[model samples]
Target: MLIEVIIKQYLDEHLDAPSFFDYPDNPPRRFVLIDRTSGGESERLPNSTVALQSYGKSKYEAMVLNDDLKKVMRNMEELNEISKVSLNADYNFTDLERKQQRYQAVFDIYHY
Candidate 1:
C-alpha cells in the first residue's frame, strides 16, 4: 500500500485525542496525536511526548511538546543511524511505519 494510505490508516487506528494541523490558510488540515502509554507506571515515563509533522503541497512543519521531544529526537537519530546502515532504507514511509509499529507494540505489551 502507499505510504500516505498506510499513514492515514495508522493515524485513524491510533490517535485518541484530536489535534489539528493547519498550514497557512489551507482549506483542510491534518488532525493528529501520538499514541503513548497511559496510566500508573507509564505516566512516570520520561519519553511521554507526541511529535506531529504535517506536510502540504509546498512545505512541511513539525511540532513536538512535553517530554516526548527528547524521545522523538532520539528515535529520529536512531532511525538515521539505521538508515545509514541500511543503504536501501525508504526513510519516509518505512521508517514511519516501523516506529508506529514499535510504539503500538510497546503500548500493547504495557497494557496487557
Candidate 2:
C-alpha cells in the first residue's frame, strides 16, 4: 500500500477522531489532516516526510491529539513495509487569523 494510505488506515483504526488527506466539507471539532510533504529513495530504500495536523476546538485538546498521534505512530515499526519511523519535529501550528487550534507533527518514515 502507499505510505499515505497505510498511515490513514492505521490512524483511523487507532484514533477516535476522523482523519483525512483534505479538509472535510463538514468537519468535526476534532480531526486530523495528513500531508506527505517530501520523499526520496536512497540505496533502494524509499523514505518520506509526512506532516500530520491535529485540530481541535481548544489548544489543550489539540495538544492531546498530537500526543495521541505520537503514541500510536511509535509502533509503526510493526508494519512490514516500514523499516523505521522517527519524529522529525512537532509544535503548535495554530492559525491565529482563522482561530483554529492545531498542532503539527512531522515524521520521517523509511520503507520498502
Q: Per-residue error at 12 for model 2, in Å?
A: 0.6
Best by TM-score: 2
Q: Candidate 2 lDDT, tens digit per residue, 43-108? A: 989999999999999999999999999998898889898999999999999968668999999999
Between which residue pairs do clashes occur in model 2?
none
Question: All predictions: root-mean-square deviation over Cα?
Answer: 14.3, 1.0
Clashing pairs in 1: 49-68
Cα TM-score per model = 0.23, 0.95
Evaluate model 2: give its lDDT.
0.93
Q: After superposition, how far is residue 48 of candidate 2 from its true place, in Å?
A: 0.4
lDDT for model 1, please: 0.27
List residue ranges in candidate 1 displaced over 4 A. Answer: 18-30, 33-112
